[model samples]
Target: MYALLPVSPLYAGLALVPLALLLFTLVVLRWRAHEAASVGMFAAAAVALAAYGLSPEALSVASGKGVWDAVFVLYVIVPALVFYHVIERADGFEALRTRITAFTENELFLVLAFGWVFVSFMQSISGFGTPIVVVAPLLLALGVKPVYSVAIPLVGHAWANTFGTLGVAWLALVQVVEMQSVAATALALGVLLWIPNLVGGLSIAWLYGRWEAVRYAFPMVAVVSLIHGGGQLAAVTVIPPEFANFFAASVGLLALAPLAAWSRYATPTDAIERRPVMAESIAATDADGSSPTAVADGGTATAADAADPADDGLMSLPMAALPFVALAAAAFVTAVVTPLSDALGSIQVGLSFPEIATSFGVVTEATAPYSPFSPLTHPGTFLLLSALVAFVVYRRKGHYEAATARADEPREAFSRTVLATAIPASIAVVSFLVMAKVMDHSGQVLVLAESAANVATPATYGFFSPLIGSLGAFMTSSNTASNILFGGLQQQTAAQLGGLSEPLILAGQSAGGAIGNAISPGNVILGTTAAGIVGREGDVLRVTIPWVALVGALVGLVIVALNAAGLLGVA
Candidate 1:
């Protein structure tokens, strides 16, 4: 039987309906991610059932897969929320701010340190929009203008999206594409991201102090990008992709303090002529949590001379930093150490379903277990353990003052965390995954790939591959979901091209998806909401789109060069 008006251009065109609706509600209607995604999911289901001839049982199984996928997503998100709350309540963020500021008083280096290095580091540990939530406020507290505060982190963290949040995006890419050369794909992705890391550092500097400031901070930018990119390349070669961002960003953060201390990139001795006064940069926030903006006259404040406010007689550096340190260490050991990986991985848990076939003759294979989530080894576990360890340490250090301890109260913290994240996040996860499942099981994605393969030449396709991945994320607002939606398509299209490198194509896709995050409305809104600019989403997107497009194009060029060299499919 024909499915969805036959496997032709017509059916492929039908496949786009769900995606179009998703983009419409999300971008034009300005709907929340969950709401738009839910609407899209239903639209996808209808297409699958009526046009594609999906059996009810198969559809049910697909929905089950989505919920199972949601479980994997929520495991990381819920724990990350708790972990962030734990740190915020204990004034760990303030401690971090004080330590970084003490390292360098220069505005340029400080922006690079927090906006580039630290933002990437946070993305590694707590992704899915967590980095912006944490780093944007840190920038604001450091006296950065609201627009710069929000925009800088969005740009700074773009390079880390695929490997960040403990490789959630990487996992999704591999799982959907079902590739054998995962290590090769990881290496290619790490190499491809070199441009973004380097460009992002320079971009941050320029955004802060313009072209002159970029020149001043140029050395730091080069060094930071090398450390970050090199670390990721080395880590992916040795370990799993999940640890790539954490390992690399850590190397970058460690290297940054020394570079700032020695280089004197923006020190008063070198650049008194062009320094932007630190105080004049911080936008005064309104009490109603409206958009905090820069002063019309660019006035200065006395607070610039003071270090970020610290808790009196409490919250020392080690006490505050130890929890995060533990978080990295735990996630690393559980994932990298073979014995621990096997031991923890053995306790696999998830749902299982029998195979079902649609009337269109598309068959989903039976699986004993699906979307398996390991309790001990998962990032969620690491985050929880880190939170508990930090909590005990903070209590021991007397960090729980009644006035400063809003996040310290367990009931309030948990309640607030759930109330804040549960609805929007959970809805987004389930609906998006269901949408992906319906499209995938209905053979819509395969037909789309076949169509692309028919029209694209190997060389030109390489030039546009990353752009394809970017489109997926722009619609879905998740690099992981982007991978799930298009990873198989990329692989199939690469296979059809004969000499084209599948890994390289995958790399470009991953890189494109990462960069796409900068312009993703869902994420931009997250940053805006955090920075108290809930209505100026257009302002954030206007700046981010140009950066993302330029970087994505650079990645596409790299992919084409690799294709010409015959290195793409060398394996």
Candidate 2:
């Protein structure tokens, strides 16, 4: 048995008080995550200082660690988002949307194909709110109801979140559990989360339409759910955990082929009229041969009735999609073409700063700073390329005059990308950092994890572990942070419960973190903002809370069944 950290019972009790306050502040007082997090962190820090004694040096160490955590998010999300915005500003996204919609007008197919498959792909590539920001606007453009647009994507691809983007959250989980491979961990979690994920998908589909939509898509949804959930489990168990989301999303997309065929032949009971792409004003103006809708919107003409081909020009779908094609190709080369990816990744910057000797203990320092113009393997690099390509395409094919006029204007292009990508991305990053730092430094997180874990009997921690995992994610607003904060605690509790396998325990931790995204304050805010439903966070929460609880409960049951069946590999 490992030696446990020693502390007075009173101090331990006091250590947990911050957690109680965190719950009250978030659940009762209804504070934003940032507010609750700060309170929790300050309280935890104070308790640690009082019980463990103050350490001036620990401050530097903690701060350094916090910065490192922030950098990790910046490296991946910032570039990815910038990349997306660049393409968006170039108007390439519209072409891609047109091509996708041309395939089928079935709303159910569109939601599943784009909302689930495409969004999952985005999540696998760039996961910080990229899915909703990118997909929601596209859905809105596709004439999907704004409310359904906001909610469907938010819930549909959630399960893949933990292992997306090189399995950042899963990596964090394993790091906390001190496990090397996340295969077993992901498998265990995947098996447990399968039902909840299925239910979530069905629920989202239902919200998209109604009982008819659910009935129509049940078979297809099942196929998607199995492919997604099963593929994810298999990837973690057999393939690299880092590739789990990428692989699962790819497989799920493939499963859609048969489903699409089936839908085409299944009978035309609900063949709703094809939703028009443009709004009434734009469509009416285009039909009247007035200023081309694009020209009117682009400010190329002052007269409302002037028909200007130069500003109103629209490109063939392929022309606009060049940038995305390039992006996908580049991303694939970087991720799958081993030599290219390695060569680019090899040009990294790594440095170790002198450890600060302080009252807290010696803390190691490390940083990997890169030039702003990193290679295409960087998500930012691909995004930038896509943007530039998209801009060129937009100019050459659509608005020749406008293109020539803006050819030399780089700042305008930059502004376009920044407005679309940075606003939401920055907010998400700030929100995540604030929540993580507070949760980590505060004793509230530990107390909360312990409190949740304590709800189950020692023997039942496996069955109940996901709830504790949910609590950690809720507090931290990040699966990665939750894993960092509670992975060890969950594993230790499971160990004491009955030598439960580390993989199963860690899987529960990752699974809980994934589901928590639905209830996560940062995500809720982003979803609401994307849907232009700002200030309705409370309403969104009211809808999401029950789903979160249900998912957690279902996961708990799976954990229990697996453990009882001796299939969980409990030690």
Candidate 3:
């Protein structure tokens, strides 16, 4: 008996049913993420057992793996939320908004600063949808419409999905596929990803003011894209892939100062006052006489002020940014400093699973230390460190006030905020991961990829490759998971098609996975939950779906051209 189902259209269509149901619930039924994901998880389990010949033991193993993966992600999500709430409680967002507006009240600059630049930075250091969850509310506090706040960051930081988060996704791809030269593969992915990088910046501008915003922001966008895309490529040549996004995003952050100082962006234009992306209620309030700062803080003193007054004192921009600065420093010491990383990475935790096989012969090999996690070197460790640092600093500075005069009251408040946000987000992420694992372990993922590859000639395989990768991400809501799920299949397909370039195909797969983050339901949930619009995930998806489709198509074309031009090894 075959270890897996033979490639066939019927099986492939069956494999897609779970994802189809997921989309139906999320988009058509307009269900909440956690609710929809639970239904989809059950659907995936049913499909695996009924159509794919998944055994009970194998299903249990896959579900276990899913929960473990969810733990890894939640480690980051919970700490990040703690950090956000810690800052928000201190009125740090209001203070930061005030300071930023003092420098430039141009809505375009502000949007790009938070949505594009800052979100990219966050992705670079800490991904797993951390950037979207953290930055969406920051944008909201800057007075961006709630939907736009979540949607913009969803689109903005997606280009960094592969190499960001300390290159976890890229590392996953490398692990799954036996590439001839890792450097060449990284370089190829870097080049292809630049298109999305440039497109992301311009898209944020367009979202702000249509074509007019794009025209005005073109020069700045170009410059930032160079630093972001070009810098990452350059870093890949000299340094390890792990620090590629970190270096580029840090440079991009520094460049913001000079870019903001430029005459065009520094002077407020009529466009600033006519923010098409903002809510009409807020716009009218701005027109009537309310300062943009007041509108930014929820349109009244009682909203943000009555909750936590800034009367004590406003923190300077640097003071407000200290937690992030600490996060960056911690990441640098652990990731970049060779001696420290080695020492800290030595202590790792992982689980062992027995080899499990389905009746259809789909066998998942047993492995020791599967997906080992280094507690000291993991991003979550750094996030927690940063949170502690922020709490201590802010507390020392008298930034927090308690409703009750108890010493542990602040700790209680932090716990409540974290639980309120982290619980729903965790449920959704776990459900998505579980569904993806069931599909993978049961051979449904392979069947889907092979079926697509079966129909495409070598000439056309390039186009379908990324779509397969995107499908993986749409299901899993993670570039790393997408790459792991499809990377080997892509490699096998490339070899089977004698005319195809393995590196180009794999690059397209990774690039497509990166762009797929825009449409991932789990990521969309993170954004909506953080932005305080949990049920409106469909609203945000409406905006991001087109961008993902457009960019995925563009990536396909680029792969087709490169493959045709015989630039396989060079790219």
Candidate 4:
């Protein structure tokens, strides 16, 4: 394909038209993701037809393959969403919030709890802006300024995008690039992703209380970040990327308790306090998973907290966390347990695409087995299973009766989730997939990438790599989309550079897309809407853009350094 495409100025620039349209609609026009992707998809199809001599049949087959590929991600979205709302209705999030108060009374640490750990944990399981939707409100409710509320979680969850959402973005990158050395790319991504992990934690702390609080929390942050970040890199060496975030977060979650205890005695004097504003009737929970109370008895809150299951007494922290626990366990067992995974893997379902060739002789190959959907091994299966478990637990604990007092409430919630998320999610997923396919099949990707390789020296390309990744993410508001659109380009550019390692360069691309999650306009708008601070999107953007740029620059620099060092088997 690369050899077939003449990397001419006109062809390269023309090939970029679709991508430019997508980015403009998303960032400048602030069009909905579905709408922008629609424009991009059409633009790509038109360009392929007029510029690349693509045939209609080839385009149809390529688009069909995209639709099939989209199934893998969309399935994850619907089930994860249903599970999240089910847990929310169960007061599970509140219970998790209450549980954090047990760790420390430091308001800064509380910010860290919600912003760093909680959001990261949520991102690990649920993608599609769930972390910001779920966590920002909690932060706002805790008296953080609206901007800080959105900014904190926005920055906090960026690091989790690749391995998080059960490797939705990571899978997109690896599969699309179709690297000869999958493990090498995975490993590089693991280590490279840690840069954002550490940045996210510090950004949250700094946003909460500036340098003073960051200084106080520095020790805790470093220790936990090392534990989680280092653990993730190590996990990828053994386990797949899907399980890396889970393994890393679990290690951090356990290590945090000891860190909390250590903070008690090693407390700094004149620590910056994060004072809370008045909340509604719902009391802020204290440590030990107790709901807020009017009075404190011997450092223990004494009250029938409204957040607890009033009709069935307070739900245990473990019970409150049952869905997540079940999900983690299910993923682990299915992934590691051979018989179960094999049984599930065998039940494959997908569209089998026949090989098709464009008029320009660009051939999109056939897949004999096609895009397979493993019924049991798929993350969506676990999500659905987890949602079911959460429903049963929430019901048995009288959560339904206490809150809704209706038999069909659960059904309504599930239906509402499907109604709200299904269409938009489908539109966004399909549009990007179509655009990716059209561009690839018509040799547009090859032309653009080869042109880039011709234009930039290896060092300049290394520095610009993250910016390219960021541009894709900013346009689509998805790390997954960025990888789908540009991962192949990154891989091709690395090969064309003559001495660069594909994995090493790809790490920067992946990391940049992850970091860009914080400043993507769609994400900013989502955060403001979810946090109940509409029309104040500018404020949120103002606070986040600088941090995102700084982190993105550092990522580029790191990539350049690694490329020059010839580390990780750089050619």
> Best candidate, TM-score-wise?
3
> Candidate 3 on 102-161: residue-level lDDT in tens?
798776888898999989998897777878877887787776778788899988998899
lDDT by residue for model 1 (405-492), tens: 4434344555564546545665676787778777777766656555655667877787778887887676556788788878877887
**lDDT order of candidates, top first:** 3, 1, 4, 2
Provide the clash count, candidate 1: 3
Model 1 segments more than 4 A misplaced = 1-9, 119-190, 206-213, 230-250, 266-311, 402-414, 469-492, 499-503, 513-546, 565-571
Question: What is the number of residue pairs that collide in model 2?
Answer: 5
lDDT of each: 0.73, 0.60, 0.81, 0.71
Number of the top lDDT candidate: 3
Q: In model 4, which runs have C-alpha deviations exceeding 4 angstroms?
A: 105-107, 118-191, 209-213, 230-248, 264-314, 405-414, 465-496, 499-503, 506-549, 565-570
Which stretch of 10 consecutive residues in model 1 shows the poorest summed lDDT?
Answer: 295-304
- Look at candidate 4 and give me any clashing residue pairs: 101-287, 102-287, 102-288
Q: Could you estimate the TM-score for every candidate?
A: 0.78, 0.73, 0.89, 0.74
After superposition, the stretches of candidate 2 with alpha carbons farther than 4 Å from their true spots are 1-68, 71-97, 125-129, 145-148, 166-186, 233-245, 263-313, 346-378, 399-428, 474-481, 499-501, 521-543
Q: Could you give candidate 2's per-residue lDDT for residues 181-278 as a string of tens digits?
A: 45556677768656656877787666655566677678778888888888777776777778878888878877766776675623333543222222
